[model samples]
Structures are given as structure tokens and as C-alpha cells.
Target: GYILFGPADSLTLFSGLLVLMLAPEFFQPLRLLAQHYHDRAAALGAAAELLDRLEDLPDKAVQKHENVRNADPGAGIVLDQVSAGFKPGQPVFSELFLTLESGSVTALTGPSGGGKSTLLHLLAGFLKPDQGEVRIFGLAPGEVRFGWLGQQPFLVHGTWADNLRLTTPDASDVAIETALRQLGLGGLIDERPEGINSPVSESGAGLSGGQGRRLSLARILVANYDLILMDEPTAGLDPDSEVYVIEALHKLAVQGKTLVFSTHQPALLTLADHILSVSGRGQVLDTSRGGGHYE
Candidate 1:
């Protein structure tokens, strides 16, 4: 049964001429646990105290000194002669070039491991290219503020509203409700004995995969950024939820917000204004090369 813990194990041989011999190795662990009971209890008490303090403390949010106006002239993203790869001898992407305008939806697609996520990470200013440049407007990648949603999103230990309000501090209750309703989370929130005030466990253990995905999407929706980049946005979604997400994305695109997302879903692909197809071998083939960059 210990094998269920994982692949690591150790076996010892104990032979007896008379017939049977079995070492009571298991009892050793129990004896040690008993000896350490007080210490463990103390540690647990300390942890409980620390968590109580954390709950009491104001969520330690970053100070919002600057205002986010509705009509801010955001910078455009430019990938100028960008080339990235793991090794000098072999490059996953080469001489890659694309520009994401201030208001458009760009869809990136390709076979598995085609460097789609890597490219997005590059554009998001996380990874530096081995060669060439990725610029956000006139500034380097770091100069701009963008909201990115990866395949898996991390949730905060609070109510669902906390996750949704990450982008706009002043987002109204009505606005949040509308977003959640569109994504089918309003009922779940209401059914919760806690309602919006319900305490969400750490990492959202109380939520299912679909619930987590919706919550993650809500977090992105609440945030109003110059550019929104989503990787595999609808991969784990159910059919109805996927439709809602696609509708929301389309609405955002129509609102003049820029979006760049990678997806394997056919419906998501159909929503794309432009597609960046990556070959299985790891190269970006842009159909928008004729001054018709990714949608």
C-alpha cells in the first residue's frame, strides 16, 4: 500500500530458520510520531495563530495610487524581427515578426509544442528573445500593462468578487454580477451558504474545474487592460461555458480592446480575425503578412 504514495521504496530481507520472521518497522514511525506529538501540536498552534492574523489583516493589496481612466491611449504591441529558441544551433522560432494593433483579436494556433505559449510569454515580457526584439509601442515589453490568462489560473483566498475585481478596483457590484451571470457563476455564488461573502478556501479547493475556469475568466474580464492575452482560453470548458466565453471575448474585441489568444477549440478558431499557425516542427506561419497582421 505504501507504493500508492509514489514510486520510491525500499525492501529488506529477514530470514529465520524456524519458520517466520517479520520486523515491526511500521511501529517505529508511530513511536516517533508519538514522541513528536507536543512539537507538532505547537507547530500547528503557531500556524493557526499566523493564519488568524492573516485573516484579520487587510488583504495586503498593492496600493493603487494611479487612476485607470476609461479612455487611455494604450500602446500598440510590436514584434519586430523577433527570433527565439532554446539553443543557438537550433531555434524554435526564427525572424518572427508581427504587430498587434491597439484594437483587434489575434488568434495563434499550431500543433502541440509549437512555441505558441512561449511566444505569448515572450510578448508578455517574461522571456527575452535569443535574437530580435518584441516592443510594446515605443517602449520595451516591460513598459506596458497587460492582463494575461494562462491555461490554469490561481485564485485568491476570498470571495469570488475578489478574483473578479483584480483589474478595476471601482468595478460596481452590478457590473460584476453581469459578468458572472454571463458565465453561469451567479447561481453557484447564491447557492453557497456564504453567498458572495462566503469564504473561499485557499487555491479554490472548493471549486470544480469548470468553476475555476469561469472564475479565472471573470478575473480577466473585470480587469480593463490595453491588451489581454489568453493561452488555451477554452480548453477545459464545457460547451455552454465555452460559448459564453467566446461571446465575451468577441464583445471585448468589438469594444476596441486588443486580444491575443491561443486555442485548439474550433469555435474559438472561428472567432479569430487572424490566425498565427505554428508548424508542428515549431515555426510561426503568419497568413497576415500582407500588412494584414493577426486579427
Candidate 2:
């Protein structure tokens, strides 16, 4: 008979091997927990800071503005002691006052980056004055019928007719052709076989700078709003194109469309019924012929 190995000795050997296998596995979770403790603490701290910042913000007050008057096509625009800026203490304008009559062309002349566009924004109600009032048609900007053209024309990847159709989708071919011709696009239309249906790249890439701008003007022309606001409508146009644009503007003024445009061009300035020279100190000096008024 073979000598029996002790049961106790076998038990001890098996137990030792089991403990060796489980020791690293048991400590792995503990090591991971230790490593992530700092991450959790950092997350908690960030959340606390966000909550504190949210709590520090002041509550906004909401009030309903009533429009008591109906739309008046001949109503004038008035800015009473208006001030505006992107930031406090670094205002674009301060306590500015002026009045613009309907069916007249008012040119705002100033150095570039001197709140000319800001003034347009204020008039369009795209921005709010920090202090003062902008009354258009005896109502707020939101309550008026107006159109705006920025320094750059906004175009899309479509035909010339398609862009114009944005303002009047139901416009006929004759109407579209007439609007284009008014903006001196007759040459441009004839150059392309597609005419008004000619393809226009996004942002008017295929068209010249002047063509794009005139196209932009064509949209407003078709809309025929009571008030038209333009910012540097002749910024990149050649001498010929500039003349055409000025003539078109004069025609609009004759049509009794209240027009306000900002420009640095001498020719554009001459067309204004009144010229308001905006100074850095928020002073509006009327420098038109026979106009010595200041506000």
C-alpha cells in the first residue's frame, strides 16, 4: 500500500495557490478607486463654481410694449437722446439726438468704424440703445415696415431670380426683369443667356463686387418698403456703377420712400437732403447746405 499524503498538507497547498491568484484581483479595484478620487473631487469643485456664477447673475425684467398707433407710411424717424455701445463705459454713441423726416434722404457721414453701422443697427432695431429712444413711424423699430442693406450683400447658391424671389416669391418675370434693369443690371443680364435665371454662386462668387451689391439693392427695390436703410451701397462699385446707383437712389427718394444711407463718398453726400456728421463725442452736426443745425 502506498503511503497516504496528509489531507492537511494538500489543503494548505491549495489554499496558498488560491490566495496568490485572488490577491492582485482584490487590490485592483482599490487602486482604481484611489486614482479616480481626485477626478471626482475636481468635478464637484467645477460644478460648485458654475452654480455660484449662475446665482450671481441678476434676473431680467420683462415688460410688454403696446403699439397704440397704426402704421403710418409718411411717419418720420426720431432719435431722442440715444446712446449705445457693445460695452459699458466704452460707448459707441452718447446722448445723440436727431430727427429725420419721411420722404427725404438723410446721409450719415463719419469716419469708418465710428458707429455708422451701429447707428444703422439702432434704426433697424437689430440693436437696442443703452439709453434713449428710436422712434420710427411713431412706433418702435419692430413695429415699422423697413428694409436694410449692409456693407456686404447676402446671396445664396441660386439663380439671380431666386434671390429676388426671397422678397417677392410671386413676382412675375416682367417684374423681376424691371427691378434688375433699374439697378443697372441690364448689361449683366444681357451678358448671360440665362438672364435673371443665370446661376449665382453662394455669396455671389461668380458676380463682380458691384454686380453683387446691385443685386442686393434689387431685392429692396422689389420689396418697395416705406423706409429703406443702406450702409455703403457703393462701397466697391466703379465710377459708372456708382453713378447708376446714385440715380436709382434719387428715383427712390422721388417715389416718396424715406431713405437713410451711410456713406463716405462725396457724390452720395451731395444727394442727401440733410447730412448729419457724427462726431466721436456723440454730437450730430448738420452740415448740409443751409443746414447749421446741431443736436
Top candidate, metric lDDT: 2
Q: For model 2, how does the per-residue alpha-carbon lDDT over 179-235 read when each residue is reduced to its tens digit? A: 899888998899999899999988687778887888888888888888999998888
User: Which regions of candidate 1 fall more than 4 Å away from where they truly are?
Assistant: 1-75, 86-89, 280-282, 288-295
Score candidate 2 by TM-score against the native. 0.74
lDDT of 1 by residue, 151-236 (tens): 87678887777767766778887778777877788888788886666767657887876678777777777776767889998888
Question: Against the hidden reference, what TM-scores do the models get?
Answer: 0.71, 0.74
lDDT of each: 0.72, 0.83
Runs in model 2 deviating more than 4 A are 1-69, 292-295
Clashes of 1: 2
- Cα-based RMSD of the predictions, in order? 10.0, 15.2
For residue 280, model 1's alpha carbon misses the true position, in angstroms, by 5.1
